[model samples]
Target: MEPVRLIMSGAVVGQELAAEFGPLPPSLLPVGTQRLYELQLAALGGTRQHLVLPETFELSAFDRERLVELNVEIAPIPEGLRLGEAVVYALNSIGAGDTPVHILHGDTLIAEPPLSEADVIVGGRRSNEYAWAEIDTDGEGRITALVDTRAGEEGREHQPVAAGYFAFGSAVDLLRSMTRMRGDFVAGVNHYLAGHSVKLARGGRWLDFGHLQTFFQSRLAVTTARAFNTVRIDGLTARKSSQDEAKIWAEAHWLQEAPPAVQVYCGRLLGFGAEDGKSFYETEYEYLPVLSELFVYGALGRQPWLRILASCEDFLRTCAGITGSGSGDAALKALAADKTLARLERFARETGFPIDAPLSFEGRACPSLVSIAERLVAAYDLQSGAPESVFHGDLCFSNILYDSRVRRIKAIDPRGLVGERPTIYGDLRYDLAKLAHSVVGRYDQIIAGRCRAERHGEDFSLAFEPIACQPWLEAALGDLSVRGVGGLSPAVRAVTVSLFLSMIPLHADKPERQKAFVANALKLFLQMERQ
Candidate 1:
């Protein structure tokens, strides 16, 4: 059987309908009413649909553009008296000859299931008995005459009720009747349907978005969906090339972007150099590609190195010290702080994953973890007055990316402000924590695989080593001190231990990796306590 042909009317019928219904009352409408038509279309497999709207109804340019993008056919009808009459006339003009047409309002989005053999299917809630008439009933509790009781309740003493939708078996006939009846169009259609047997299909949520309040609520719903699901391939690809590219894209286009001071602070902390002498726009353009690639690849599970790089970049930025001040600035700062860790934590909790257990360190603990912890405490103890610089307060895995092809790393999303040098010095341990957690958590599996692969003595570097981690950490920190934020070791041992402890559960899959993380965290905590 062919897909059902859907015709939508009443694009802005809600405004007038709501006014007619009386004063606006606040209430949470159904979720279906608040979602955008685009998302509804996606849910129903986009195909075989036509939308009809009156010219009087004002639709945003963006909405129109979106309709076009979704390949929806839009037909404009003359606006004036009996807008419903105009819509029926348009549907009759365009529908397939004599075919049963499914008519719905623009605000009503339905999830399309395979069509049943019934001649006509009308959907409504069984609970809305007063507003709906049970014309026919099967032996079972099934309903058949669920015709719209909208007009009956409209201006009545009872609470207002509406079917908000209708379906017709005789599309051509309904159109003709609508044109002739004009002002009495809806009544005529109901009269016509009364003579014919119509099947009532119960189920599906209904939303009425015919008011300013409903419209506002619907906008928020749409924004939430766009923020989470919208994909920008170009933006993602661009970020992989450079840190600046990712920063620009995240700040300017991505729903998340850090504030200017925070952005500057992050850069300084991460050893991105002073924003004073640099071209901000140029730097962002250069960085976006790198950041994008790192994010996409990391998400794809193609590169493990990104775990360290991203952590390091973000840590450095946060240590530098970029803070949120005003509303706009706060928004930017939040944008820069990558919330991946929080997201992962939530996901793990929801999925019932054990994420709060202590990690098991193998026979040997990471020496670097101890050394880094001690150094951090010493730096913090000195109370060295470091120059104020910018920082990405939430430096975590999600904000950083590592490009395997170039063997380079980049950072995106920054938060606080600090001296450039101090930011770098303090942030060095972040990457080490990430690496240790990953290696310790996944240690057994990685080692097993490496051992199997190197049975014939082939090279393998799957192990996590303090020796390897230290170089990158030191280099990044040193660069920040020398070129960006003034050199002041602001590294806090407590923060380092906390970071390591957080990663323990994430590395649960690898016992050795898990162990390493625990060992490191314990050592760091001990060092901090001593200091």
Candidate 2:
């Protein structure tokens, strides 16, 4: 079949033409220049002819040159002619008797091939506004109406078929009919076809670059289609120009601020390490410390006063305790057998801490420790069971922030059941044990480093040395007779050891390492039982 001749007319012909005239170098074409060069190549493939009309530019040297090169003809319509009229004039000048003319508006860019079977092809719905409305029908899909308007409706109910491109069997007949009707060529064609048989071809992807917004939108679409990776540093500037003022302001004001790095880093590490160790350890590990520093500064170090008060409260309320109604000895035996206490005892043993060793009954391991903790609670109960309170369930170097400038330790990341003085006393030793275990291997190094850095280095380590668990344990558990709890400390130690042992599985790369960690934790637990 002979190729179809494409004709286009519009006001912004210069800017919108190349997008429609496929495969032409944008830089080579002049404003308002007919892209006959590209059309000639397309004609060689199958298209028959091409034509363009710029209402203002009548006959130019560029037009004549393009006409000669394209082996086509040109006609200059008078000024003040509408695009539809100019299209009719161009169709007539080309001798409509010989070939089928395909009329396309300059603003439309064809991204796909035209239909081969249809005499008239139009683009499909490209936006929500132009969506086809479905009618409630009894039968399968059929074109029931060219246009339908409901009562009191402001607009037509049928889908709006855009008149961007259309072809006719007889160009002259169509043009003459359009001229006689005194209407736009599209309306004229639709009117002529009011009674005639016509077929509708499904449309392809057609982009309209008519307005400034659509022009940029189309450009962005094209860039995305071509997979061009373009980055703009001023995203807000581009967004503002695109008329998203709210988003522009939001991004400028809120989302651009620096985030807490430590939390971000730790969260990432936990997620990544759990999900993909090869990826996390090899690629993401180096950046963890840097991000963690931000968290330390912002959340941990900056908020010491809050941490200290909270820690003290938690210590008073959850860590101290009391024997309920039973014989203090029996209660102490049960406490010693408790799994949580056994775990702590095991933890002390595996980590090489003195908390797991046999005690001389009166110290921390004695039954009196529980009675003492309870008595401390009873004292508070006498004073209406209220005391200045705060608590950090997990109090340790990991959760505590040491402010070098102020020489104060701040606690963080509190957890556990918080309540009155008795309840707090019940969980006191657990917190202390947790703190002591956390500072095991590196406590001296950290204290020495801090002391050396202080200007008034009046043996700061001495003050911290007194706070260690050994003295506290000895004072609390001195003799076996008064030891209120038979195996409470050992049980707590076992639980702590089990938890630390479980952590090894998280960082262990080898199965043997994990097995070893578990075996060692079990041995520690058994030792707690013996104690």
The best candidate in terms of TM-score? 1
Window of ten residues with lowest summed lDDT in model 2: 282-291
Which portions of model 2 show Cα errors greater than 4 Å? 1-4, 13-47, 58-75, 113-115, 126-160, 224-531
- TM-scores of the candidates are 0.36, 0.34
Best by lDDT: 1
Model 1 scores a C-alpha lDDT of 0.39
Query: What is the Cα-based lDDT of residue 236 in candidate 1?
Result: 13
lDDT of 2 by residue, 1-531 (tens): 353565464333333332222222221221111222342333223435555544354443433564566665444455456655766666666555645556655555555435453345453443433322222221432222234334334443444455365655666566766787573654566554554344554454555554333443444433211111111212112111113233222222221221332122111111111121111111111101111111111112223333343333333333233223323222222222233344444444454433322322211132211222222222111222222122234454444433333433433323322221122112333444344333321232221221111111111111111222334332232221112221135434443443443344242334333333333333334444466
> Candidate 2: lDDT over CA atoms?
0.36
lDDT value, residue 43 of candidate 1: 42
Model 1 Cα shift for residue 34 (angstroms): 12
Model 2, position 321: C-alpha lDDT score: 35
Ten-residue stretch with the least lDDT total in model 1: 451-460
